[model samples]
Target: MDTHLKMIDFDFEKLRPIGLTQVVVNSLGAMQDTTPPGSRLMRIVETQRDWFTLHDGDAEHRARIAQRLVNVLQMQDSTVTVGDWAVVTEGGADDLWIAALLAPVTQIARRANDGRRQSLASNVDTALLTMGLDDDFNPRRVERYIAMVRAGDVAPVVVLTKSDIARDAQERIAMLRERLPASVPIVAVNGMSEHARTELMPWLHQGQTLVLLGSSGAGKSTLTNTLTGAFTQDTGGVRRGDGRGMHTTTARSMHLCPQGACIIDTPGLRTWRPDADGAALAAAFDDIETLARQCQFRDCRHQGEPGCAVQQHIAPDRLMNFRKLMRDAERSEQTPLERIAIRKKWKSLHKAGAVRARDKRR
Candidate 1:
């Protein structure tokens, strides 16, 4: 097979009998294409109904092949589902063929089947949490996104959209800065302006992968179209009163930016559940952990402890935010057993500290 030059212009013959090395450009309708020798594939271009516009080279094509692959493979191995980029190698191709060779191949194996984990996307470096300045902005929602990204071992960056509509943009940005870790980048962007492109340009450099996540009507699709320099996805109008757009984007897809960065845009989430443990939350809220270390007791709740160092050094408002997050973490805990254990452990520690304080006063 000839080594095609463009990522999207692959010769069908070059596709190995096993599987092709392609990125899911449109996940809703299953569009995908094989990368030629020199060209690269990026993440999510556009989503509409079951079809999606996937930018493979300079031109965007609509197809459902990628989605078909995901569905068939998932039946055999749920982990084989959509979202990852692959460098189709001879050896890897052979393994896939063998996996496909099994009789009556299934896309999703029963839970009783052998342990096999499928991946949504591979080689992802970062996850961009995009929230609109409109009514969609919620600190709790951002926290949920952070947890999910961290659980996937991907770095999270908060992208605040529609800054042009916000009267107190600086104030809102300051609030996020206080609540979020300093390491995470918080960028305010107006999708309609060139300024937004400039602010996001640095992150779009080659070899990087970014995923856009937010609630519907948060301008996620608009941002995707803005980055790609075209009206790739259909734009939906937001409700005038609530500023929520009708869930225009319906699938998860990947697209490659002109600069070589890969981005994945997912459908707006109505409710995001962090399928992770407390550790990811702890990492997201490191400041709270540092304050907790100063508390009189190892497990001080920071509610009203006599020698609570958290209450002493941290501002009252900051403490309240910390507590609220901890409570949210408790609520997000997956298993009842885990929640019960965490509750019991904290209760014992708080009770012991209270008893010690009473004795000292006597």
Candidate 2:
């Protein structure tokens, strides 16, 4: 058997329709040389507990990670996610096995509340940060999503869903425009309408992969259905009063849009703690960072610091949100040992304070 895979033997053309660009193919450098016998390059459309749905731009197939690849993933503390390209082989009895995965050009990820890093989607070009204009409307939450998406090197588009019902849609959009960078696109649309397909046409071009990230009842599934021109995903309404979604999208799955693009609809993220460092977090809120540079103090935290330019110029709510996100980013950057040491120090202080309180009572 040849150690080198003959490029001619593999039909790379078959994978082009499903977002296989020359750039991704070029990134395959050494991975292309290690192709197993009788293997095919496929893109993961959906990932479940122990299996994945793969597509070669022609048909979909079910596959599980090959034991060899699973062991490698375990060692790296990584799991395969949607929008990933995989090298798959057909085992006996028509069973498909993913032997290896190509490196993703971009990924949307976040640090969970438990301090674990989770990959939402990979090889994504743009992220549609869907948010409802109703009670679910939250500019700060949208900022967090933008930070997470931008940290992954993916373009962020704010999609304001439920525009038909929300009377203050324009006001909300204006607020987001003022809060977010001008470069970020914000589109308001009713996700269930055909107008949504027209409004989002720019990002729905051929060979592009887009991911929907937002809370439940934000209309991700509705947007997915509209884009695909079918009920590919189920849609549900938000709960009354609180307006929280009912988790209609249980898993992340990729659907092909009628406009020749791929859309990965993810389940609503209940708690999204961005997995970014100080620099990345700063990059997300460039406006505040720009203002911070003009402060009189070198390490001005913008919290009532003398000559703080950010405090004077930026909105109070936006500034507060940035500070909170910065704290979260710092916490997420801590190592296990560093976290343990801090916990122990805090524990000691708490114990000392309790002892003093007891002495005072006596």
Residues 109-195, candidate 1: write the lDDT tens digits. 111212234233444567778998778878767865775676667787899998998777888889988877788889999976767
Clashing pairs in 2: none
The local distance difference test score of each candidate is 0.59, 0.87
Q: Tens digit of lDDT per residue, candidate 2, span 88-195? A: 888889998998888889987777677766889999999999999999999989988888788889999999998999987888888888888898899999888999
Q: Estimate each model's TM-score.
A: 0.64, 0.94
Instruction: Give Cα distance to truth, residue 264, candidate 2, Å.
Output: 0.3
Least accurate stretch of 10 residues (summed lDDT) in model 2?
Answer: 1-10
lDDT of 2: 0.87
lDDT score, candidate 1, position 25: 22
User: What TM-score does model 1 achieve against the real structure?
Assistant: 0.64
Residue-level error in angstroms, candidate 2, position 100: 0.1
